[model samples]
Target: MEQTYIKKILKTRVYEVAKKTPLDYATNLSRRFNNHIWIKREDLQPVFSFKLRGAYNKMANLSEDILAKGVIAASAGNHAQGVALSAAKLKIPATIVMPKTTPEIKVAAVQSWGAEVVLHGTTYDDASKYAQQLVEQQGLSYIHPYDDEDVIAGQGTIGMEILHEHSGKLDAIFVPVGGGGLIAGVATYIKYLRPEVKVIGVEPDDAGCLHAALKAQERVILDQVGIFADGVAVRQVGKLPFEIARTHVDEVLLVNTDEICAAIKDIFEETRTITEPAGALALAGLKQFIARENCNGCHLITIASGANMNFDRLGYVTERTEIGEKREALMAVTIPERLGSFRQFCHAVGQHFITEFNYRYADDEKAYLFVGVRLNDGLEKDRLIAKLRDKEYPVIDMTDNEMAKSHIRHMVGGHTQSLANERLYRFEFPERPGALLHFLTRMGQRWNISLFHYRNHGAAYGRILVGIQVPDEQLNELQNFLENLGYPYWGEANNPAYQLFLN
Candidate 1:
């Protein structure tokens, strides 16, 4: 059978790759899943992903005539590095076309593999179209990222290696889906050798084109893809790989940005390895499935496919980790007509830091405010709900909803006030210090500060507004204290009077 012959080549490739990589068991995940979970350590591949398997296999099998013509590929991640390293090894010049938005880290890593990197267009489709044109004009052999048979066979070798290394008892293999070459190759080999071994594909929820296509029984194109998992945010999966997946893959799961961030942080904390969001998708999917289905007492293997992470992106990953774990509570607080009511509301919130606060009174009636609080670590959502219900406050949890997190956090307030004249204050403090109360208590006048606003908004310090009646001369003493307090202070008393009337 053609499949049998291909498996033979995959067998040889598997032997070679196993000699090159480590089959390190992931103790943290294993303990949590109650299964002997192991990482293929493809991230430890010479090119930082399993992509080298396919690239080298394809190049090694190339005819002398084709080798002389060189090779080209369009990839924004592992495939680029794989092709670069493989072509360099085979002494074949390679040109890689990548999406313009590909991370600098990936681009630099691919270049380091000795391939010429051409950054073009905004998506993989754009670069891939350009690559096709180059194949015709430049007479270069175009290496389909995952569409070709050889590339799939090469990726299959990783599956062969897994069976050999893991005592031949893998319950399932989790693979991250992109162009689908990696999973296709892997799934084909997995099905041929161990038909029952589940091959699950993980995809970004924002770019689950493959899963969408599988459901539709045809190719589907996404109009927009999330760039957070830039490496695997493919708008569509390859036709050939899709065929292989439709037949052999057991399931495909979609993970959102928060889940991917949680997986990335989990790996970093447990193994001290940082992976790109796409690389973490498989683990995120596994965690979701395990939680929803109780996948305990079963062996699972995850391919931490790549690690070419940009240093700057780590901050966003860390910031979203809380959101992923549901440890940050975001809400819009609506306050009614009363003076000590604001003070009572403050007292009502127990054991939480006000991470963000914004306030404005549209009319004389009600003030709309945005409030975010840092939940105590390990607090249960039900307890949080109960705590909020016990108080005379309305708390709607937007932690799990992405639409709410991005847009709602911005538009959470609406105007309910009819009276206008509100005051604004611009206060600047050192990057630190008890800036809020320190400024508030220093005012020395109880002008009934009507509105307040602040966002723990990652600024050098912070900004807030206090709608207290403008005490023209009292500001001098206030300004004196702020200046002596070693921070910049500006009185916004000159704020345009009518700006307040517009709500």
Candidate 2:
């Protein structure tokens, strides 16, 4: 039962496994971060994760008669594949009960490995109950994802390999934590062998079960869980793993969804290998800790635990990375409706990329702008509004304003196709005096407004939705001159949603 001896068994299990996974040295990260860095590439393992090590050990430890009876497991995704593949290798029957909401790809993978896949429940708790019932009814072994000793010992093999391949001393090892089995095993083994080696655990900030449980000095259940990192989105840490991690883990770092996405992009750029959100978490944690603690020139290793990514989810990943880098931030800015107010709005900041600019006019209130700003290094976020304030313009920070970003930004781009040709859009904008009259003077009487919708929403600049009926041939010429005026505009008529619903 002593964990120190578990490493010996893990070594035996390592020989049993057929995968000689590479402990890839990260050349790019080492040079960029100025640290000796390497990746423990368990993401490239045969089962595409370290889960198989635990799953296989648990199965092999069973008695001959118990093995004949088969095994059952309930997992959201990764562990199901682990057990399915492990049992199939042992020539024993395996039945995997997964949440119905589990991604189609993981389901197909489990079935391909010859496991009977039963889609049940919307959450892991429900699927687990179903698996327990099956264990009782069929007298089959209930193989846990990480709650058993044998499983822990098997997963410890990774720590052994890490030390074997990464020579000399290690300043710290960052690992992604879910239910704590991986950390429990790796931390326990590492601390026993190298007491000074820091074993830091990373958990999704939205679902910090292990971190919470370890802090409480007992396993605790979370009332809610986040599914962004589906593989690590557990509500509670297992009791057995909790015990090991509580005493061994040096620290627990919590990272958000955006940070995890950025880390995923970073690793993909480095190795050209895609990792699930959960897998990228260790590296996210490392960057987070280094920044917080101001660490430099330390030997660091991050375990990339799995690679079971939902391919379709890449679009969401791409979207979040824009926001994560602060290269693109969403916020609402109010500018008065007037002649020069529009020009003043552009002059507030020295230079920044405009990702999106949407405006709508209502009730002569201020013209509202939903703006996205591109981020660059050394450009602190707080400085933007200060520069605008110097110009006597007001900007509202909505970087964390999820509702305005997700829902409003999409609707604001809708086309003006609903307006009749005779309708005129006049810029009654600019809250400052002499602004609207100046705008009219600059237009040189060439424009006629058929429809006018302008609002000075108590802001410096006002926006108006203008519709003009000109010769169809004049479209390109008028647009070219409008661009010279230095205001951003979108042609909503070309939006896909315009064609689908509005048309």
Candidate 3:
């Protein structure tokens, strides 16, 4: 099996459309981690992602008759651009079915390649179903994003290039896993040649299909996947890729949204380039592995996967970077509702930089203060909390509190004493134009909105927190309404942060 894939990868003509991306040395990261870090610059590909290699390879291997009938693909963004460009290069008709919620820039990029863009549904799965229908109806050839063998072989060329570029002692190579094609392909070639070199796979914790599959010893579908790293937000690993991964891929590591954000900043500091969350995934894993293993002066590599980032999303990434790096901490501190009490609390927090402070008077005796403190190290947060406690100030660590970080911090003083029967929810609203208005229309003024907080993070989706008043008798109606609304939501009525800062 290894020999067959190795031969196929070596013979693949990915170079017709995909360039051999350079393996770059991250000097800053290398020095900080005490390891020689090499980054595979797949983001520099013409289509700005490694998807071009697989997309083109799949199309190129097609029979002349199939090519004449045109090709079709479904993608949220990156793969769509890859297929569109490949079709243009081959002068064949191409139809790309993309999610309606895909970023505008990506839709334009695909259209720029002369491929017909069909904005079909709200998710990649929906678009894929429509694409399959079109494939059968139009007699068009389907180019899968990551499943087919030809596609995997094309991706395997990256492994071939990596071995050719760095002849030194490479300790490990980290690859980001979506549907597992990249890892499967790279692991196959690397294991076949340099059997000692480890091939690690990285994935976001919320969308770790490959990790879940490996643990189950079979392919398994995830109930839901977080779309923060939309490029790699797959719910299931492809069957072929999972089979390869079960045997070749060394291990899978999971990183959270904040860790992924920190990695994006790290990549920018080194390469002066901002990568999407999924692009920075491998480097994030590499850093975690280095810290866990306490290895020094060893050669490590991570693939910088893609650069098609939404400019609007950078603000959110910047906000989370410090927290992700464990250099910042958030807390809810309670003190006497008097001037001298604040002064005493400030003295307790002496010399520590305050990144944010929010205080609101709930009564004449006590006050709730939401504070963000910059920490020199992760342990400093504990020290600061201890100091505050010694001063008789009640403090709650809000650093890992999702409600505080996402919504409560933004609306700290929105407590209402007169409102009743209000329930809180966090929703992922599609970021398309009029989406909010559409949500309002669906809500239909049936229930009174007690509290609403929305701040655009500039991705394909909006993080929204809403408080709706529903009488006890209308609980079933509210549940039915949310289910019919069709957006991912979580109830936060009993969230500790909500109780501390808002309730």
Task: List all candidate RMSDs to the true structure.
Answer: 12.5, 15.1, 1.3
**Model 3: how far is 481 from its true place, Å?**
2.0
Itemize residue pairs with steric clashes in candidate 3: none
- Write the number of the candidate with greater TM-score, choosing between 2 and 3: 3
**What is the clash count of model 1?**
5
- Lowest-scoring 10 consecutive residues by lDDT in candidate 3? 408-417
Q: Quickly count the clashes in candidate 3.
A: 0
In order of listing, the candidates' clash counts read 5, 34, 0
Clashing pairs in 1: 363-417, 363-418, 363-419, 364-418, 364-419
Worst 10 residues of 2 by lDDT: 494-503
Which residues of candidate 3, in runs, are more than 4 Å off?
none
Q: Taking the tens digit of each residue's C-alpha lDDT, what string does model 2 give over 199-256?
A: 9999988799988987888888887666678788888998888877877898899988
Q: By TM-score, rank the candidates, best first.
A: 3, 2, 1
Instruction: Please name the candidate that would achieve the greatest lDDT relative to the true structure.
Output: 3
Instruction: Please tell me which predicted candidate would have the highest TM-score against the true structure.
Output: 3
| TM-score for each predicted model, relative to the true structure | 0.76, 0.80, 0.98
- Give per-residue CA lDDT, model 3, range 386-502, as digits (tens): 989988888999898776887888899836788889999999988887888888999897899988899888777889999999999999999999999989999999887888777
